[model samples]
Target: MQQIAIAQAAEGMVLAKDVETGDNRILCGKGTALSAAIIERFRRMDISHITVEGHPVVEEGAKSLKEELLDVENRFSKVRHIKPLLYLKKRIQERLIASRRPQPAAKSEGS
Candidate 1:
């Protein structure tokens, strides 16, 4: 799931989490596919951000996974000799790869 600014949201994106009101009431449940009207309603409700089901929105100039992993490697190079630090670096890389994996799109989500 990815939390993104509501301005960046568009129609057809599925919600990964519930959108709640200020009083903790669910305005929209998870798996709700966004539509123009719903988005507009959210705007009027003062909602700033929401969690979407997948990494569907791509920003310009975002780094690829290879570049990101290389950056992690470079930063951890100095501590590669330290056993604990090396393990931590490995775990971080694992999580990055896991997060970047494609999620299966829901075909009947909105239906």
Candidate 2:
């Protein structure tokens, strides 16, 4: 499944997880195919992201994860000497890598 920002979500995509409101009430359930109305509702509610059934976002000729790490390192080179800034850069790089990794599929009852 791919976790995508609300703006990236489109109609007919199956939801991989339940979408809940800030107060913990489920607005939509898992396996629900998104529609224009639902997408609009999510936008209205300002939901940041939701996990969908597949990799909907296409990356054509984009930098690989390693390349991205290197880019981030280079961008922070000037501030590397600053302890707190360096720590923040390291954390950002880690999050980038983690987010790019492919998530394992959820197990079904038959399995």
Candidate 3:
């Protein structure tokens, strides 16, 4: 599963997680297959992103995984020796990789 910006969401994609509004109203349940109408509704609600059960939608000009990992390492270099911070850095790195990994595309109507 991957979180993608609403602008990148396409029809027929299944949501991996529930989508909720700012005040905690559930807009859509998890596992819902998105459609053009649903997507438009989300846009109207000002939703920015949603977790989908498929490959991440890499934005144009996004950083490569290697570049991202290196940047994260560099950012945490100064506090590497700190035990608590080291753990935090490790968790951050894990999440970074997960977010960047490519998965199979969501099934479309044509499939």
Name the candidate that leads on lDDT.
1
Pick the winner on lDDT between candidates 2 and 3: 3
Ranking by TM-score: 1, 3, 2
Q: Give the C-alpha miss distance for residue 26 in model 1, angstroms.
A: 2.3
Candidate 3 wrongly placed segments (more than 4 Å):
1-7, 20-25, 35-55, 102-111
Q: How much lDDT does each candidate structure score?
A: 0.83, 0.79, 0.80
lDDT string, candidate 1, 1-111, tens digits? 678999988887878889999999999888788888889989999999999875777777988789889999999989967999999999999987866665554432345
As for TM-score, the candidate ahead, 1 or 2, is 1
Q: Please give each candidate's TM-score.
A: 0.68, 0.54, 0.58
lDDT of 3 by residue, 29-91 (tens): 876778898899999999999998745576679787788889989999899579999998889
Best by TM-score: 1
Q: Can you give the lDDT of residue 57 in candidate 3?
A: 72
C-alpha lDDT of residue 93 in model 2? 89
State how far residue 106 of model 3 sits from its true place (Å): 10
Q: RMSD in angstroms, all models?
A: 3.0, 6.8, 4.7
Model 2, which residues run further than 4 Å from truth? Answer: 60-111
Off by over 4 Å in 1: 35-37, 106-111
Clashing pairs in 2: none
